[model samples]
Target chain A: MAKIKNLAELRKMREEQQKQLNLREKSNDPEKYVQIKVGMATSGIASGAKRIMDFLIVELDKRGIEAVVTQTGDMGYCYAEPTIEVTRPGEEPIVFGYVDTQRADEIIEKYIKNGELVEGIIPVNYESID
Target chain B: MAQQLKMQLLVCGGTGCRASESESIEAALARELKAHGLENEAKVITTGCFGFCEKGPIVKVHPDNTFYTQVTPADAREIVEEHVLKGRKVERLLYTDPENKEHVPDSRHMGFYRKQIRIALRNCGFINPENIDEYLARDGYEALGKCLAEMTPDAVIDIMKKSGLRGRGGGGFPTGLKWEITRKSVADQKYVVCNADEGDPGAFMDRSILEGDPHAILEAMAICGYAIGATKGLIYIRAEYPLAIKRLKIAIDQAMEYGLLGKNIFETGFDFDVELRYGAGAFVCGEETALIHSMEGSRGEPTFKPPFPSVEGYMGKPTNVNNVETFANVPIIINKGADWFASIGTERSKGTKVFALAGKINNVGLIEVPMGTTLREVIFEIGGGIKDGKEFKAVQTGGPSGGCLTQKHLDIPIEYETLVEAGSMMGSGGMIVMDEDDCMVSMAKFYLEFTVEESCGKCSPCRIGNKRLHEMLETVTEGKATMETLEKLKNLSNVIKDTSLCGLGQTAPNPVLSTLNNFWDEYLEHVEDHKCRAGACKSLMRYVIIPDNCVGCTACARNCPVNCISGERKQVHEIDQSTCIKCGTCMEKCKFNAIEIV
Candidate 1:
């Protein structure tokens, strides 16, 4: 937490910071861990994304799943509330829609834990905003 | 440790969403979480504008990425109980895609976000603007650090020039050139000015940027200070933007604490600092000279531009001024090479421009797209088309300064040069989409009315010419305008453009001229037929009782505030045209759909 004195120090700090922001996974290698991105736009949040988020993090830790969860800006599917794009190790990110606490736990148990898909899978038809 | 572990619930606390009770939504969420004893496991936080104001009061659940739209405070308990406790997604609250009628569970799949590439607005809805750590975690200050330690003033300016980032503040002047001019200006004291005074009628992009990502502006300003050899930076934001001003103050203080701004920043011995100056929200103060004058405690009036603000600004010192969005683009441009930035937009205008997408559009919010993205894409793909399936008639870009572009110009790539060449300059990106219902004459009058009121009156052409333009528009909408008045309006607008002292006067007649060019037939219909086809101008429209539809139930007569409807009960009724108020109350009250407008 010291003040960055030079460019080298700043770069080092950025490296550490980048690891923390590893939730975003700029490398795009899904094999590292289970990656989950919560649609955090106004629409998603208004439809109870908060509740779903709390459920996912708590249940994941309790269930002992090695998943890195992060908040991302809107991907434009506002009609779908409590949506999450889940990427298992060495798998394509499959987005699930209308995720409640029950769905969140089911996804962590079946999808993240057992590598099985669940209901409310939002079909991906467009490229994500990189 | 507990704070970061638990799921983070981000509620939009932007001005628009906050007005729609997002604060109460946040508080309701917090209360509901505690009631269920999940408060410790769930953290409810208020972030900045989510840009999608139409579907505001957004609640985003982290890790799962559940995007909830149009959430009410009443839905808080159900959210906590069903979604939080029972792990069940709320069915009714989910946003139903207009196209497929499918419940879209993710924001990434929405039509509104398909084409948008968020750079200037990257952090808007994602991060809490008040938090310094959040900003730092997003690679915020690294640009400033790199600029100071790695690149010289000339080198930094060269990158900016190569990036081809023109000013997002309407004029489309090159940002690098502006900085170089300031760098070359021999001055005892130099300054970096951030123009946060966004005065366009429908535009809120700048305000949202400040509220959503205040640190972006600060970091960019610090870099500008280093690039232009300035020690002091000033953000001249309007006083009307209370939320933006509040967020900016927090960001500046946090930057100072983190050694990002002020003395010895990034250990590079760069003694740059940012200060906030509040404007009274004068529309003319958006002009650089007027903004500088307003900052220096003078009347917000723009003088001649032989010596632009770069040469002499802010108490007659060399100052470099960049609009909020322009600065927001600076950091990423430096981080991701000039080529990376330049490759996104058109040949002339590189990087993206943030637009406050408003008016009759389905997705009324803020958006950032690459410069060449056509108006059609913005209106349909990103905007989710016009609201209520209304046919798009025209779109007014750049507020009063820009022109009205019709269906023909939809495919034209929206660059600064293209917009200006098509008779509309890309003024501070405010795209107000008009529908079939919107009267062109009335729309023109509305803009001219704004200009006439906001003109500083320092120049006679703007003062008198804009007023005359407004009057002619008024006459047209009233169906009393002669052909001579139209000719007079056009000639007067040209004269105003030529003789104006500043940008305010120079572009004041754009709406009138643009509307006249794009919607000439609509104007002629008003002047010749004495009718408004769109039924927008109340004066040119008349309320009538359809004889075939009228049941003579006396509903129309009873409901008419002016008692214009006459005829016996259960018989064919007629609306007394002369006495009718055109309030449409009778039409609304009539269950039989009896009333019609002629």
Candidate 2:
């Protein structure tokens, strides 16, 4: 990382970086990667979603799990907060609610690594556009 | 390579559910799964608010999207045994509609959420806000990327000006015009600011957005920086919002790491980064000038404005400031074109407004409805009418700074212009529904008291006018005021509104003026007849025990804290007016309906 001198050099460097980013994104199948989606919606944030999301990302890497993590807005379930939605290849995405750091660690070890369902599995009994 | 599968459980983590012990419910479900040796089989997650807040704590099992409402710790064992173990939906905990008693399996199909168009609250309960990648998946920075890649600084301002999206934080000022003013201003350094200092009582619309979607504000500010050619953004949030502040910090840090913020954003040569500045719980700081002053480490006070924040603000540089709710709507407007954003709201006021629907309303939560949605629809259809089947009297919009609108104004469309025309301004969209039991005279006094305390005392109008107004209200409510005092109140209110320096002093007289206009008869009755119709004014009200209805039940006598009630075994109880202290305990305790407020 070098200090950006002026706007022109900054634009050139950005263009090069964007090209690399596009190439990487194009080469890899986004859906194929183990997608870990956390609910950071207003209700979710009120319920401490940031802490759980932070815990999961750091812990997942520490545990040597190769996964792609991201955030989305409200899933409409404002009651159960700090919700995380995890999807593996060729399987339906599952949503877990009321996740803390302890639960995030368990989710990474059991659900992400061992392919097992952990506690706090909130069954989606409704139709959602997402 | 061995592929591993994962499960996601989305729980409604809104404040409504959290108060119902949703945290405990989450813990119990986890414990139960671990105990049953199925901990490896499931993963529990918490998400942002599910809209239906009444039947919370709501648990939704994803992939299947099984919606469970009113889940308790006691029901966790059964949920694990029945749902997780046997792969069957728990029949008991599922949400049953109150109208027809039919089980609603999906939240989308629920009658409550069928009409809602969730744009501001798009990523609230779905993605983890702490992760920048999840924001990326939802096309978060694509707008910023588009703005930087193709559009120039002036062009971005032009698009926003055409969008017609006004500020949602009380005053409906055009957001683009503010940006344009800031962009055109000559300054060596410029700044972008987010006003998360929401101080309106019972208003949590800003709080919910910050908690659920902090990334949106970050993204919007970054885009604003690119448009205004600023490299830094500051979010001045109240220290009271711990969850919101924490999430905002996390989101900012994560954005910096992902190259969404800091230096070049999305490889578009836009270097914008946001920092958090917490307020020490001052109500007046909600005003932009006051907010800028506070950020400059001065006491939160409003200054005389010829040069607004857009011209000269925040360390005396050209700054653009919008509240949390206003910034929340920016991303959607840019992503889905200006016309699409302009189409939903009223002719003048564009896009939806998020209201903290509270006070006697059934749906006591955060609701975002398009501007021009009638108060009747919001109160009756959406809010499910008043609690305990009470007659609707008035709906107070805009907190202490707004006027109280009666049932006559219910059909008037709720836009900035219409609301102001109806003797009320949409001050941050805090609609507090009041029933017939609420006394208008007393309500006016209550809001006046709030304004008097929150006044910055910089000017004479707010400081002196609020005191005089409060004294007059007190006199009227105490049955001591005359018609002459009423005239004084009217004259004083007008002077205050006209002479005030800032919005706080200007709108301080709204409650007094609006109440006097709508509930003039109520005030006259209190002064002329010396009677409080609602029995709310303690000085004017008296508790009388009726002999016919009294069965000599000693309940009222025993419950009276001041020992005001006296009666024989078989006769009626009498409340001694002198000793009563007007506590109304005897009135509440009389089971035989003996006691009445006169």
Candidate 3:
């Protein structure tokens, strides 16, 4: 830790440290950021969902995208094994099925950064009670 | 690196929650997280007061947003295993609504926090206070940086004046005006003082701010130093608040390390330093003059204010003193602009007030609500009404020096002028609610006892006057005062209020005066009727044995300490009222509901 020499240094240090608290800031208002929910139930974990979730978390930060990545219970898509739900601000959520680390990268690059639909799209087959 | 953290377990590390083993809860959560290998995925951070202290030690799981109340250290494993691993909420630990018996998921939906604005307490429960990085992440010293880099001294003061923030330390004096007064005062050495000696009985708002966001106070003080042209700052805090003192020391050290407090702060050639002066928890020291006197190693007694602390404060120099909560609001006002801070509260009073909500309230905690909020909304909606479904009675705002307001005053907006008009001043935001069982006379007596004990005795009106007032209240509660005594009590209270020197003596008689005005009939019952409706005054109560209900009931006679009950076997008993001590032991021992108090 260096002594803050001036206002510029203080402001720069604050910006660097602000990123450390970005997860908390994003969770406070999930709608303002890109929200990704990884299915982490037994079925999802059996298909290496943990690696994909970790990959998404690290890559999203590296790419300088404001996003919240959280784990959900079974999305009731056991057949897909590893699935993820991606919901942009004020939009319908899109679930991608059988997501390996490569597919997760593709989802981030195309669907998230470019706003383009990618392969392995799992459409909503059931309706919520609400 | 921040994105790696998937969840946050925010354990409340406030003094109240710490007393309830929140430290162990934090440790337990950490251990459980390690056991599950989720330490990296989930972070355990101990935050300051959530203000929901009744249900503490509170464990709030962030990102998922699960608020668990009254969480024991043993419940940590279940939280990590169920909530963290399986993404499921612990059902039993959730806060159940006292009304609907439904489990509240998070703090947002709960009635306790629903009405709160939380300006002063914004980063309190959210960020880790001890960690300076966390503070910096929340734009901690950005206000100081902005003020130094862009704004002039007058510009900063102008912004504060426009924000309309008054002193939260009971005076309600404009903070900007106080700074301006000190700025104008010509002195070789100027001082900026923070009055952290919060002596109100049920008040901990200052303590919470100091403990939770100490950096905010340092930042605000530096900003004040810049405004008032003071190089030296002193925090006059009470010795009783050990945790607050500890955190303040840490924050000052951190700020100094960052070159935010020491010489040449922000490399702008402005040198400012802050030091802490501990008081012996004297109530009079909360007054600015007395606080300065104490800081100067003199007796903590207030002198007349012809030359106010702004002109002649510590060592007879120009000084600007602000409360902890008042300083806590400064950085935000600077960051968000004056109009943003001014828009929330009432016409005269701006920004939210943090109150330590206590006494007969269902959710006894700390709350920050906007001005002009009705007492009814605070007590019923936010405070969760009176405890045990009891009928609402009078509420004593302020502390010993404040007045008690009754049911009719509930709808009045809680502004500075409004509270003073309703026979109570918002003295440091100690809102103590009373239930139907609480006798107003006894309540007044309780406050008088505090004033009598805490009085500095510098003035006869306060020292001798409060003593006499306490004795008079004693006689009234003991059912020994005549109508003449009541009249004398009223006159003496007025005299004390008029002749007292400082704010302490001036407001010492408020409890007595307010209760006398509001609950006159209850006081009259003690004097004339010799009856206490609430049965709080034991001297006014006469224990009588119901003739028809009693059947010999030697059980009561056997249990009576004074042997006041007399009866033959299988016959109705009579209670010897003169001999009875009113201990209620006979009443408890009566198997047949025989003993009754009249």
Q: Which candidate leads the pack in lDDT?
A: 3
Among these predictions, the greatest DockQ belongs to: 3
TM-score for candidate 3, residues paired by index = 0.97
Candidate 3, Cα interface RMSD: 2.5
Q: Put the candidates in lDDT order, highest first.
A: 3, 1, 2
lDDT of 2 at B235: 95
Of candidates 3 and 2, the better by lDDT: 3
Candidate 2's C-alpha lDDT?
A: 0.79
Worst 10 residues of 3 chain B by lDDT: B1-10
**For residues B191-287, what per-residue lDDT tens digits would candidate 2 score against the true structure?**
9999988988888888888877888999899889988878999999999888788888888877776667888665656678899998998889999
lDDT at residue B48 of model 2 (Cα atoms): 69
Model 1: residues >4 Å from true position, as ranges? A8-130, B1-6, B35-40, B543-596
Candidate 3 residue lDDT tens string, B276-342: 9999999999998999989999999999987998998899999898999999999999999999999
Query: Residues B55-85, candidate 1, lDDT per residue (tens digit)?
Result: 8878876544567899999989988776665
Candidates 1 and 2, the one with greater DockQ: 1
- After aligning candidate 1 to the native by TM-score, how far in Å is the CA of B152 from where it should be? 0.7
